[model samples]
Target: GAPPPPPARAGGWAGAGSPLLSPGEVRSKPMTVLQWEKLSMGKLAHTLWGDGGSDGGAKGAAGALEKLMEPGRAFEIDISALEGRFARPDPSARFRRAESDNSDRSTVGSADGGTPRARISLLEPKRSTSVGIVENKLRGALGGKPLRDAILEVDEALLTQDTLKMALSAVPTTAEQALLLAFQGEPSTLDRPEQLLRSLCGIPRLEGRILAMMFKAQLEPDMDELLQQVDSLKAACEAVQGSAELQALMQIVLHIGNALNAGTARGNAAGFRPSALLKLAEHKAADKKTTLLHYTVEVVQTNAPKVRRVTALLPTLAQASRVSLEELRAKSADLARGMDQVERELTALEEAAEKEEERREALHREAMEAWSAAKEQRDEARRRHREGRAAARASEGGGGGGGGGG
Candidate 1:
């Protein structure tokens, strides 16, 4: 036959005698016997002569040729396969594997493929710490389910602030995540800890779930504490307002202030600002020793001794003073926001779980339908075979009777 046309190139098939026809390209395209021989010779020359330049290239070419031409080797060369055999390994892939190995080895019991105790040990190096204790408690609270499943199925009561915190801390690191993802395609290769880690990583928005749980755990206690603080502050304000001793003391201070300003424009003032109490010590007596505060104390001791009981309110007032109303408001707002966030995360988790359940059901339904269809097809085939056999037997019997009659 006439020489077959060359295979189409990327742009289009090269024209006859095109100088751009590479050795590999020429080999890949259709060619006559003479053309194949000529190209094969060219390939041999190129492999032997080292791209027609460089001593290093010559040495590499010779090394490659020697390997290819060794005893028992086929004379024919597959350039594509040979290139593949010599291709450099991906650096990033190598790095990831190294990192994964390091992470596995770093865990306490990963080498032995991990036991329950070993898995627990992997949570923290120092098991005596509070965090470790919480992690242990969390593990128990999870009821032996994988962390991912526990996030979905665990009772709300089982999730405490410390346990949630521990769970958050125990979330897999990047290297572990990578390892787990790699093992997803080959789950049987995973060790116990790896299996658990893989499952934990598999949960949708796992970090968000743990965070929501943490926020939920803190919500009640924080709200209760905030309410208690507000109540205490209200009670303190009420006590200050209702205290006869405090009222009496304020009255005395007012009278003393009016008397001191007797002849001035401020004389007989209706009442002094409460902030004036801070300056009582600045007002000295004639001897430059006794302050107005001291004189007020003496007067209270002699005339209104019952008013001395106001001293008891000092500690409560001091504490109330330290409690910034603005800060409390901010805290309350933050708690509210946190609660909202928790609700959103929980809603998302529920939806995700529902969707997963639906997907599973759909797959199961599909499998059943497929199985039913197959079974029906099998039954039909059997029925047809039986009917065919019966028809053949009847036909043979009729023919035999006819032959007998004849």
Candidate 2:
């Protein structure tokens, strides 16, 4: 409850310290309405009830408040003058209630004791100071009604921090997970924002952090899967790279290609890209039954039977050959970039949790796991990459020496 207003002045409200102004008179006021809003509640109370003490000493304000609420005394202010000269409009339209009875009315008396109406504005309601405008932008991407209901359930206490954490945790960590969640609802209920989020599509700046966290959570599994594919491809490429069996097998195919293109510019070419291996089966003989590659296979079986099993080395060659070596290297580089970003995000999350011991500890554990997994996968990839490079170097040297000889 508010401390009561000060008592009416004894000399019929004539002095500068008077609560209400006499008619046809004006006096300088201390604060504009906007400035009044900026004042603390304690300072505002002092502004309204304190004596003419410039130093803001506690004695004058306390004494004035004590005197104001003394029994049977009425303190008043000129509302019309305040409204016309001093009041500034508040955008938030918040105000404090002054009367104990929950009524908006206050009594003003004339010489004949007739009542007159007056209006007084008070303080604004407290706002959530911790929330920033940037974080609020996420609401648009979070699905409006559901997010609003969630916020209502959580209330405004520590709302900004708590909502951020909830968003990070609730978002799907992978495209597959997100898809499952999205379809869990009825087909008719599908919406654009939900669809986008479920598909791991990027959101706007306000909601971007949550999406980033989701991507970070997915990095470990994604890296593992990528490394597995890379290992398979690298193993296949290495097996085909330096094998004398593969060289003999290719020598048969090269002779066929050259004979078919004899006396043409294509026949003069020394070598072709390894990716052209797939085209071998497409070129049929004049009989339209046996392919050039089939004849090469027959030649390998007839002349170099021990090297016939060279074809067995590349079990995944069809799938692996669809991607170039450059593409493989690029994918590995992209994983490295993603790991770097995740590390930076983990560091930031840790710093933000400085005041929260439990969260900080949990983040520390997660960071350790993420770093260790990334390091192990990276080291394995480096070892495979070295093997792939050595095989490629050996293949190039062997192929160059026997150029056109077949």
Candidate 3:
């Protein structure tokens, strides 16, 4: 039988060819690649050799591209899997190499394989800070307000592109991919609120949720993954058998894990009611194991430092498992304080409004009373005039009759 359909794609030129076509039949070997050699070296140097001066690690990759593109040579480009390094994991953070000439590009991509991604917050928080400071200074120099607006406009514009759809479509980094994609924009590149949101987003899906949060915020993916990751952590915890911190961590981890099963059947979908994500699991370690409520406090307490520490320190803390009673009380108090202040403000506004309404009613009553009194006076004067005229007419008739003497 004849050879099958040609391969679908090749190195940057997608949809231009088909599969099942051999190198010989396709005539796509290194020989036909010579034309690229004739292109301008300035552009070529940037493309092939890569930037030698900076990011010494990527320099090798660039050089490899240059060698493959050499004229009069036959070759084909393919990659089994691509590896990517992330600078910043925070959504607001950008992937950059100032020294690298190619810093202009949003993400480092391989034509065939996807690029790697990470949250800036997860690694190198210091670098994240320096980038932010530089951007702030630049904006200050350039009249600030317009720069931010302009950047937002650019990002929004890019997000609407059909071609960008291609980049976003590949289930490329299906696992926790949001944080990795955070470092894609530059200072002047953002073009709208959405872009800025996407830029400011941390840990991808989670950060995106916060930036795009509506009144009813929900985290679908993480809620789903919570169970599996917890199970792994729980087993690790039990196996450790020592360290109070470790045990506490395991307790919370198991709590979260149990929540996954307690809800709807998982696997078909990893989703939970916010009620479950918000609360701890039912399982309890009697006496000192702490109730689920206390477990929750332990969780928040443990994670607070972890989020900050994650910026510069190690992934030293995972799942934020320990919450002190005092910390829990403090957090609860703070939450209540916020609600109280809002209530007080609302009450004061309502009282002032009510008073204003009462004053308006009083003024209306006074005006109506005055108007009624004036109308009564006008009516009474008209009645008296009519009566006097009637009396005068009666007297004139009687006098005329007497004078006639009839």
How many clashes in each candidate?
0, 1, 36
Best prediction by TM-score: 1
TM-score of each: 0.50, 0.35, 0.23
Worst 10 residues of 2 by lDDT: 121-130
Relative to the true structure, candidate 1 reaches a TM of: 0.50
Model 2 lDDT on a 0 to 1 scale: 0.45
lDDT of 3 at 139: 43
Residue by residue across 273-346, what tens digits does model 2's lDDT show?
44456666764443446554665565445444555656676666666766577876877887777666667656
Cα lDDT tens digits for candidate 3, 154-269: 34332223322222221123332354355465635532322333333333233222122211122244344444555555644443322223222322332223221221222111
What does candidate 1's lDDT look like per residue over 107-139, in tens digits?
A: 445364433334332334332243345445666
Which residue runs of candidate 3 sit more than 4 Å off their true CA positions? 1-317, 321-334, 395-406
Candidate 1 lDDT (Cα, 0 to 1)? 0.55
Candidate number that wins on TM-score, 1 or 3: 1
| Model 1 lDDT at residue 194 | 51
